[model samples]
Target: MKLSQLKILDAIVSSQSLKQAAEKCHKTQPALTMAMQKLEQDIGFTLIDRSGYRLKLTPAGERFYKQAKRVLSGCDELDKISSTLALGYEPSICIAYEQLAGDQRISQLFGNVIQQFPRTQFKIVGGSRFQAVEKLAKGEVDIGIGPWFDIFHASGDFQSVLLKPIDVILVASPKILANGRTTLTSDELDDIPCLTLKPTELPFDDEKLSFAKGSQVVMVEELATLRSLLLQGVGWGLAAKHVCKTELENGDLVQIRLSDDEDQFQSELRAFRSNRNFYGPVASAIWQGLQELY
Candidate 1:
């Protein structure tokens, strides 16, 4: 019937002892028992089964407790919303990123934003190319960071900037190299399987320069998974220089050079923000900070 009484019931159910519930509520046991009795009288039902040593909720009591917990949760969320609004901070913002967004750089840039606006909360979502772009176009996120392909569609309202380029080198397990040569011909590469990013959007083509276009290729959803496949000698694939630096250094994988220098591949990382969303003080700071990060 009352919010405080519901809270008491929640404490009792959670602690499983009336005395413990009284302690949690910071009240004397007798006063707590009296409040509970008054609640039951108002509701006209037995809310607890006291026949056992540990207090248990009766059938009806269980149902009431479940609804009471939801009410409490709603109350907490309302408090949070009110506090955030009072502080003049945005409720929440999401950043959708491609899996290749280097975690270290992202973290460092965000650290500066957090220092300036500690109350601002950030939600990061990472996925493959098409998925990240779609989330941004649909207004599911405020910003996006990923490899930018001209073919990926974006509306006129979206503003974008090209970040630093990420070098993508073809790599495979050293064991996969048959001739013990650092360079391989395109025809030779076409013979073995090459892990490739699965297309998720329309009018898909082998956009990036690749030698394994028509060769035995495995379509994958993420670079990390593709690296795993390459590590096991499952196939060769183009990977970001940052992601494969450790593996290449430790001899877990080796970069393959193409005999034709023209076949080199590189993708420019880009950031996008929808102009429709009002960039509040915090969002504006973040948006500007990201552009300067690159």
Candidate 2:
């Protein structure tokens, strides 16, 4: 019933010898045995089979040991969280991001931040476009990284800092660009389907989005899915330079340069945080890390 008794029980089960369990628990063999006896009496069941040379658990004893182990694990986690809280650290920091954010850079930034705050829990959530911003505003995430233009104008509840420009070039599978043409005109794009990401919080269509004027369009929520569809020659749409770098180099896909300078594709990515004056220690560290990363 007591935590100490559970520890003794677990030690006995693991060591398979009462003598070894007592040494491991830093208690005398008699004290450990008496504790086990009291526990069995309290539970109204025998926990161990002493007839064997090596300590063995009864069928019921195995079940109780398993549950006790889980309880001990929970206690350990509770202690860790409590210790982190006492040190003025947030228990967790969640970040939600759009696919256009550079994965390699994000990985590096996160790794550095984690090393600095070893006790802080981290969660990364991915969605298309403004979804990350919505999560930040709703307090579902501590930080949001994605396109900023629309998001900046859409919400006053959050503050944002420009991180970097995401270079999105129109691209399609080689088969879709079978004509071997480097340039695509607006008229040509009308006949070809355009794969695009669907914003989780806003309308499907954004007039300001690059190539939004394409007549044939397919909307999806994840960039990975759109990439897969593009590789299948389903359509053509603007893709992050880093995301399609391998494909572009391998000739599996090729960029479609816009014929008009007026239609050049590019978007700015920014890190957004809630406007609240206080960000928990972990979240504040993450925000500063992101600022330095860009």
What Cα-based lDDT does every candidate model obtain? 0.77, 0.78
Q: Estimate each model's TM-score.
A: 0.63, 0.64
lDDT of 1 by residue, 1-294 (tens): 789998898889989998899999999888878888999999999999999999999999999887887788667556655755687776676888787877677778777777777667778888875566677765568788887776665342667787788887888898888976769888777887988887654335344534566577688877678878899999888778887889999999988887965445777788887665555666677777777776
Off by over 4 Å in 2: 1-87, 203-210
Model 2, 118-196: lDDT tens per residue?
8778888888767877676545676888877753655546788888787767788879764688687777777888788
Residue 144 in candidate 1, Cα distance off native in Å: 0.5
Clash tally for model 2: 0
